[model samples]
Each structure stands twice: as structure tokens, then as C-alpha cells.
Target: MPFVLYLLGLAVFAQGMSEFMLSGLIPDIARDLQVSVPAAGALTSAFAVGMVVGAPLMALLSRRWSRRTALLFFLTVFLLVHVAGALTTSYPLLLVTRVVAALANAGFLAVALSTAAALAPPGAKGRAASVLVGGITLACVAGVPGGALLGQLWGWRSAFWAVALLSVPALFAILARVPAGAGDASGTGVRAELRALRAPRAVLTLLLGALVNGATFCAFTYLAPLVTEVAGLGEGWVPGVLALFGAGAFLGSAAGGRLADRGPVGPLLAAGAVLSAGWVLFAVAAPHPVALPVLAFVQGVLSFAVGSALISRVLYEATGAPNLAGASATAAFNVGAALGPWLGGIAIAASLGYRSPPAVSAVLSALALVVAVAAARVGRPGAVVVEPTR
Candidate 1:
């Protein structure tokens, strides 16, 4: 394991922390700013909307440049956005900054994933992806807990300030280390790249990720309501349980990486099963205190474990266009991000039978599993950068 990989990991860690920390502190911000909870909470949604908007735009715009330079600019922009967030007093202004930061983050992640793939030593691409993805998992474990504590103590403003400060160390490390420059043109043109991505196998892999992530989030985004409303848990206890769920997620990512290294298909298949099982359990036993943690742990693991394999699958298909493939995956993931909340919200609104969400999610996961299984049958093992044999 080279030190450079660790530096890239730090960049990812810091960026992830910034994005996720907002969720835990929304209440604090809303109260402090004298705004509605949804108004204050719009910051999180703004960030996702930014990612949805920026993922493809930034990837395509930066297509002509070296990934390193493009990624560096993205990181720099995120740093500035954090600074603006820390300094802003107006709610609308703060939302704008979050949007800017998120846009930069979308581009940063796309480049970082590809760079990590290119940088990985022979036969270790999965490990490199793990290191990068681990940052996201670990952010939930660390960032949410730490931010909540800070918001409880000093105030929500203090938390953003902390993120701004951490940005300095992360930016310094990524720029100083991590050889990120791009290379001479490979003769594979953009049109050819797009053509390959439209292949049935490639589209299936993307949709699998999209559906799985959507299903997971359909359950996750409303986890607080699920815990409080369904399980009859107190509001005060919600954060603690969420922390436990984050821990379960970290473990899942670790196990998933190890399993994927052995074979991506097997772990993906297992995760999809786990996802379906978890949702069923959640739908059935959500009211039981013991079952809450049990279901949460399972869903956390399955949701992200399969995500690790999805990255490998996307890269394998888009060998000629690492940036494009990586960006498309990001877009798909965000699309699912948007879809889950919408789907869950609708279920809740319609007075559909109780447990409709997790039940629906189970069906979505089952479909994703089917797609993944079909995909595994066609592709060769490992993250092979398959080029058209001339």
C-alpha cells in the first residue's frame, strides 16, 4: 500500500465528511436560523441536486484535460465553498454554497475513482476502490457522530467551521501526493466510448446499481421516521441508533471489499440477497426494538457492499472512458438517491398499507439482483479494461 493511496483516501474522507455532516446538524441549524426544519434541511437536498446537475457536466467539461488537474480544481472549489458556508449568515446564501461544494464534490469523486483505479498496482484495483469507497463509509461512522456532538456543544456553525479547517489538511495532502496527471490520447474517441456504454450489459450494470441504491435509500432516508414511528423509539435515542447503523455499514464495506477481491459477482449476489432479506425483516419487525438494529445492520451492509462491486462492473465496461464510466455511475447513484426519497415519500403520503416502503424496496433489490446475476454471466472475472481487439 503506497502512501499516495492513503493521501487520496484522506481527500475522499474529507469530502465525504463535508457532504454527510450536514444531516446530523440540520435541527441545530434550523433552530438557530429561526427557519422551518425543511428550510434548514434543504441544504442536504441542495447538495444532492448539485451532484445530480454537476456529475455529467463536470465530467464532460473536463474530458479534454488531465484528470489530475481537473480533480485538483474541483477540490479547490470545494474548499472555497466550505469557506463560504462557514462565513455565510443568510440561509439562501448558505444553500448556494452547499450547491457549489456538492458540484465540486461530484467531479472530485469521478476523477478520484478513476485515478485510484489507474494508480492501483497490478491486480489491486479493487483494493484501491475500497480505499476510496471506505472514506464514504467511514464518514458515516465518524463524520455524523462528530458533527452531531459538535452541533450539540458549540453550535451547527462550529461544525461547518471544523469541516472548513479539515479541508486544508486534505487539500494539501492530495495536491502534495497522488500522481494524478493524465496521459496521451488513446485513439478511443468519445463517440466510441458512448457507444460501448450503451451495450446491454453495461446499461444493466448501471441500472442494477441505480435500483439497489434507490431501494437502500428508500429505507435509509426515512430511517428516523422508521425508528420513531414504526419502532416507537424516542427522538432522543435516534442518533445513537443511527451511529450503530453507521458502524454496521463500515463493517459491511470492509467485508464486501474482501469478498469482491475474491470475486465481485459472488459478493454482489450475496449483498442483493441480504438487501431483500433486510427489507423484509424491516417491514415485518420494524416495531420491535431488537429488530430495529438487526434490520439496520443488515441493510447497511448489503446496500454498500454491492455498491463496491458496481464500481468494478462499471469500470470493466468503460475501459476506454474511465472518466465517463465513473461519472455515469455517480449520476446513476445520485439518480437513485433522488428516487428513493421520492418513492418512500409517496408511499407514506398515499396511506398505502403500512410497511409498503420496505416491501417495495425488497422488490427493487430483487430486480437488481436479477440484473447483476445476468451481468455476471457475460463478463470475465476481475476489473479487466477490455478494449476492442483490433
Candidate 2:
């Protein structure tokens, strides 16, 4: 179990590193590719779109396979495509690679979570899911900074190559540790997986993922700008701002997981409250760097807190349709990722202050909280989550 979990973490680390490496490298990419910074940013968008397109397709394709086999295939594409992203020189090709690589990454992550759950001991599935997702938490804790440094010192391509290199070792680890013939996480047949999607509970879980992610993106997409233009800080401070943000993210994620184990709804409520309050703070602090850190820390914690709960909720609800539920969650996150940045960008372009994005984000979080509460009110024994402590 430890070996497989470690491999899953490695895979997630690679994915997280790949997704965020571009954050610090966008300027370099623009300069080298002879495009505007906004254009360079398109690569990030393309990766997200690919996740949307690829998630469901891959999930469907792997219906007949065990979660292990499905994951292995997904990572094969995941590793190679990232290497392709590193090798490409043409801007268009780079965009294509980003899309393909991220699609594979999306599918791979869903499967990793499923596989981890399958491997868990009885009555500790939440811990298992947390272990799978810990990679992203770790990425926030360390991978982003490390990737950014590589991008800063070597080049953006080198950063991608570093991510690709990490994959080689992870792939080898997966091949060595994971046993064959593992069952699906939910023990549902392929046909049952399809049927589970029709369940209202599954649908609600997906909506929660989308709404929460949308709020997360809205507040965070403009973080750099919020800390700079709004606070009148120089670019030199960007690294520190991001680092602090990541630290907050790490703390929040760890705490949230424990909270979810105690009561699923508890963590969700706290996170949504933090999101709303954090955004309000952003609105007030846009002009003050000192205030930004306080908000940023809370922002990071709240932003990342939902994922474990959401993924677990969907998986638990999907019952007969675990794969589909997993894939749907990925799609929902992509939707949020897309919606968040586009809205934030538009707000920025319209001469709205940086606070505008988080303000908008606050509204979305409020909506998510409302939906979560509604789900609780409906209170179907299995439909509304209470999540007892371990």
C-alpha cells in the first residue's frame, strides 16, 4: 500500500508541477516565443481545455480495465506528452502538447484516486483519498516553488523537462509496486458505472465541485496582479507572494482533510466561509500589501480544502459509477479552472480593480455554500453527507 501510494503521489507531483511550472515561466515563454504575455498564458488555458475533453473519453475507454491498468495507460501518455511539451519549439505545437499532456494528466489523476481508495483498509477511505491527493498538496507546499526556480534559472523548457524527468522515475515505481488484477474502487461493473451518473446525488456532487472551483479560480487567477497593481508592489516580491500563498494552501489542505474525516460538511462549510471572508478581505486589501498576505494565507487554505471532500463525496455517491463520477469531477474542475481565469481576465481588462475577481469569487463561494446547504437540507440518508469522525 505504501509503495503504490508513493507512486500515486509521484504521478500527482508531476502533474501539479507541469500545471504550475508555466506560472513563473510565462514571461520567458513570451519572450522566447515572440508572443504577448497573454498569448503565453493561453498554454495554461489549453491544458485545462484538454482535461475537459480527455477526462470523460478516457474514463469511458477504461471501463473494461481495472483501475490499475487504466491508470498505467494514462500515465504512459502523461509522461511522454510532457516530454513532447518540452521538445516543441513552435508556439502552436507547444499549445497542442499542453492540451494533450493535461488531458492525460486529468484522466490519470482520477484513476490514481480510485486506485488508492481500492487499496485502502476498511473504514479509512478518506485517508486513502487524501493520500492520493496529497501530491497536489505537496505541490503547493514545495513543487511549485521548485519548478519556478528551475524555470527561473534554467528556462521554461528546462522546467518542463524536469517534470518529464520526474515522470520517468514515477512510471518505473508504478510498474514495480502496483499489483495486477485490482478491482474497481467501487466494485461496480462498467454498466453500473454508467448508471450511477443518472443518480441525483452524483449530479449534485459534480455541481458542488464546479461551483467551488469556479470560486477558487476567480479569487486566485489574479493573485499576482492583486499583490502588485492593487498593492503597488514590485515584481521582485512576486516570488514571496506566491510562496506565502502556497504555504497557506499547504496548511489548509492538511487541516481540511482531517476536518473532512471528522465531518465532511464541516470542512466544506469552513472552506466556503473562508473563501467568502477571504474575498471580502481582498476587496479591502487590494491597495495594501500587508493586508494581502493575511487574505492570501486564508485564500490558499480555503481554495484547496474542497478537493478531497468533493472527490470523496462523488466517489461515495457514484457507488455503481465510480469511474464516471471520478471523471465528472475532473471535468467539473476544468470548468471551474476555465471559468475562473476568463472571468478574472475580463475583470482586469475592464479596469476593474484586482478586488473585482475575488469579489466575484466570493459570490461563487456563497453559491456553493448555498448548494451544499441545500444538499444537506434534502438530507437523503446517503445523499446529504455528514461524514462522521474516524
Candidate 3:
């Protein structure tokens, strides 16, 4: 793998920290802004909504630009948004900043995915994609918790400042290393790209990606409660458990990438099946103190293994529309991210215990497995061919 891939991963880590660190800063933000905690939490939701909308839109708009240009543009915008967010006193302005930051983040991610694949040596695209995914897992492991610590010591604004600073090195590295013409649009026009998405295999693969991610977040979004309330651990154990899960995710990403390079369908089907069963086991063992951490790590491994493979598969299936392929995958994952927590919350509201989230997650994973099996049966593996737009 080229060192530039690692630079792209670094950029992703900074953006991902921004996405998740807000959870730890909600109370501080509410107090500082004189808003309710839920209102403050809306900032996170706003970012998620922006990501879902921005990926495809930005990809379409920037398709004609060189990948390096698009990436630098988005990273600069992201840096500026965080600085603006840090300095803002008005809650509404901060909310606007969050949405704008998310837009930039989404665009950069969409572009980076294709750029990584383009830059890698032939037959190593899956490993390249995993490098990017590893950045997110690393963010979960270190960046988010470090942001929380910064918030605790200084203020929530400090975390924003830190994110902005982190973007500086990524900006310079991308400028220095990423090839100028990498991931340049194929001249297929937006219509041809849109048509590629309509293929039955591509559609099913996208659904599979969403379901796999939804299952992950369904359980993950409520992990703290499972650790403290069900497993009888103290609040202090939450961070360690989350870190353990993240470590597993990082390893899984690397392993999945290598597996995907050989072929995506076989590994995806196998991992998806095990992931579904893992969630069921997780739910059953939630109340056992020793079992909770062990299962959390195992589930994290299985989840990202499936996720990385599905993403690589999506990219392969949409080869005719390279730019849109990455953006669509981004949108699908975010859609799952949003829906999973919502579903888990509903289960909790219905008087199901904290264990219910994992149970819900199990169902979602099974659905993903079903979709994967259907996708495998539908289309021959590899990119769909589309006529060039005249």
C-alpha cells in the first residue's frame, strides 16, 4: 500500500472524531448555550442528516474536478467549519456549522474512497479501502476518548479546536502525496452513473450494506447502558470496553480487506452469518460481567469485517460509476447509522431491557445476511458495464 493511503486515513480519522466526540460534550454544550441537552444533541443529528444528503450531491457536483482538488476543497471547508463552530456563541450558528462541517466531511469521504481504490495497485483495492476504514476504527479507539478528555479539562470548544488542528497535517499530506489526476471522472455523465445504481445487483448490495451497518449501531449506540446497568460495571468501564471494541474493529478491517481482495461474496456471506449469530450471543450474555467485554470485542470484529467486505463489493459492483459508487456507499452506511439507533430506542421504550438492542441488532444482521445471499445469486461478480454518455 502507498503511504498516501495512510494520509487519507489520517484525514478520515479527524473527521470521524468530530462525528462521535459530540456525544461526550453534549452537557457542556447545553450549559454553555443555555439549551436543553436534547437540543444540543440535535447537533449530532444534524450532522448525520447532512452526511446522508451530502455524499451523492457533492460527488455529482465535483465529479468533473480532479480528485485531489475535490479532496483539498472539502478538507479546507471542514477545517473552517470547525473553527467557526468553536468561536460561535449562538446555538443556531453552531448548528449551521455542524451541518456545513458534515457536508464537507461527507464529500471528502466519498472522494477518498474512490481515490484510495484508484491509487492502490491492481488487486489490492480492498486493502486500500480497509485502510480508510481503519482510520474510523482508530478514531473510535483514541480520538473520541481523547476529545472527551480535552472537553473535560478545558471546554467543548477545545475539542473543536483540536479537530481543526488535526485537519492541518492531513491537508498538507494530501496536497503533497495524492496524485493530481487520480479518480478523475470517467466522462459518463450523471445519467449514466444514476443508471448504474438501478442495476438489481447494485441495489441489493446497497441494501446489504445498510442492514449490516444498522445492526452494528443498533447495539453499539446503547453499549454504555449494557456495560453499566446490565453487566454491573462502573461508568469507568465504559471507555475501556469501547476501546476494546474499537481495537477489534481495526484488526477486523485489515483482515477483511485482505479477504475481500480474494473475493468479496464468500467472506461477506460467512461473516454476515456469524455476525448475526454473534449478536444473539451478545444479547444473551449481556448480563454477565465477564461475557460483556469479550462479546463486545467479538461483535466489533465481526461487524467491521462484514462492513468492509460489503463496501468493497459495492465498489466492485458499481465500477462504471466510480465516484457515485463511493458516495452511495457512504449514504447507505449513514442511513443505517441513523435507523439503527432509532430502532434500538424504540425497543427500549417498549420496556425491553438494555439487552433488547442486541436482540434487535441480531434481527437486522439476519436481514443483512438474507440480502447478501440474494445479491450473490443475482449478478455475476465484478463491475457492471454501462455505455459511455455521448
Highest TM-score: which candidate?
2
TM value for model 1: 0.84
Model 3 agreement with the true structure over 1-390: per-residue lDDT tens digits: 888889999999999889867655665788899996446656766786788899999988788888899999999999999999999999999989988998898899999987877777877777888999899888778876677667767888999999999999999999998888876766777888889887766776677778888888777767766877899997567667777777788888888777666743555577778999999999999999999999988988998887776666667667777779889878887777767766776787778877998999999999877755654566543222112221
Off by over 4 Å in 2: 66-68, 183-191, 264-267, 378-384
lDDT-wise, the better of 1 and 2 is 2
State the C-alpha lDDT per candidate. Answer: 0.69, 0.70, 0.80
Give the candidate order by descending lDDT: 3, 2, 1
Candidate 2 worst ten-residue window by lDDT: 380-389
lDDT of 2 by residue, 118-228 (tens): 676655555666665667667755776676667667777888888878888777777777776554654467777778877877777677777777777666556655666
- Candidate 3 clashing pairs? none
Which TM-score value belongs to model 2?
0.89
Tens-digit lDDT track for model 1 on 1-390?
566766767777777777667556766677777885445545665776787788878877777777667867898898888888877788989989988988898888777766766776665655667787788777767876677677777877777877777778877776666455642124467787788778765677677777887786666656655666778886565566667666777776666555445553454576578778778878888889788877777777777777666655676666667667667767777666656656765676677643666777887788776665655667633221222211
Candidate 1: segments with Cα more than 4 A from true spot: 26-43, 87-92, 180-187, 228-236, 258-261, 264-267, 349-360, 373-390
What's the TM-score of each model vs. the native? 0.84, 0.89, 0.88
For candidate 3, the 10 contiguous residues with the lowest summed lDDT are 381-390
